[model samples]
Target: MNADEMARELASLGRRVAALEATARPPAVPAMLDQHLDADTVLYAGLGGWDGQTLAWQVVRGWDEIRSAPADASAGVLAALANPTRVRIATELLRRRLTTAELAQRLDQPSPGQLFHHLKELLAAGVVHQPERGTYAVREQHVIPLLSVLCAVLDLRPSVPWEDS
Candidate 1:
């Protein structure tokens, strides 16, 4: 096409793009805890992402109202927990806090190196924290939320005996 025709086509394309952007809805923001929540109240938070064609979500909950972290942060946490070793480490921490050496021993690691590697992943994901030198524990704020996500992923439901219905 000639220059004039090409210029007109580009201008039309820009206008269409501007119109689409103006009409498109902004991404949803996750909920936040407002005030001091009661102990019994269960709060669930979720993160969602869309990539043109596919959309995905992950939900987490706690006994008390908890604010949802950003999508990127939540994804990082899930990615860290996706590993078997990291899940075990987090579970061990749930029972009681332990030092790096104790955790390595309990998990039956031949050396602390491998354990530390997994621990580092957990630490970076914010699922586990080191309060002092050599000690580690699941972040208190993440315990219930992590369990909630696990339960949701597992899709736990009431079981019935074959003849009991």
Candidate 2:
């Protein structure tokens, strides 16, 4: 083979070796989660806010502890995100901090009062916070947790339509 052809063949062989090495490596077993029957976490690093920072979370709670916790412990947080408008605001905030006017414009919410109303609920629930006077963002520490919750809920799709009783 010519020099160019031989060089291309060598590069392809390197990639195949790398793929084989990756597959040969053992899976990272979440031993703590498996042994304790608890959940792991979601890791996220993104460009967000004016001074962006990586968001990391590793919450591991025993099933019994989770079950025994006060039922209302998360009510405010969940209830705040139950609304369509609030969910939109939250998901947007996850990417970057936004002002009240920006949020309203993006969500097509014409009423400033209405936008504030929803923001208030989110602020109270700890789902979001105002960085300055009016700009809002998902709390830095809560970013991964919030994404985990959204992903888990989104996985609740049914395989087939349910028949009437």
Q: What TM-score fits each model? A: 0.52, 0.66
Per-residue CA lDDT of model 1 for 109-128, tens digit only, reads 88777888999899898888
Q: On a 0 to 100 scale, what is the lDDT of residue 116 in model 1?
A: 85
How many backbone overlaps does candidate 2 show?
A: 0
Cα lDDT, all candidates: 0.72, 0.76
RMSD of 2: 6.9
Clashes of 1: 0
Q: How well does candidate 1 score on lDDT at residue 33?
A: 62
Count of clashes, each model: 0, 0
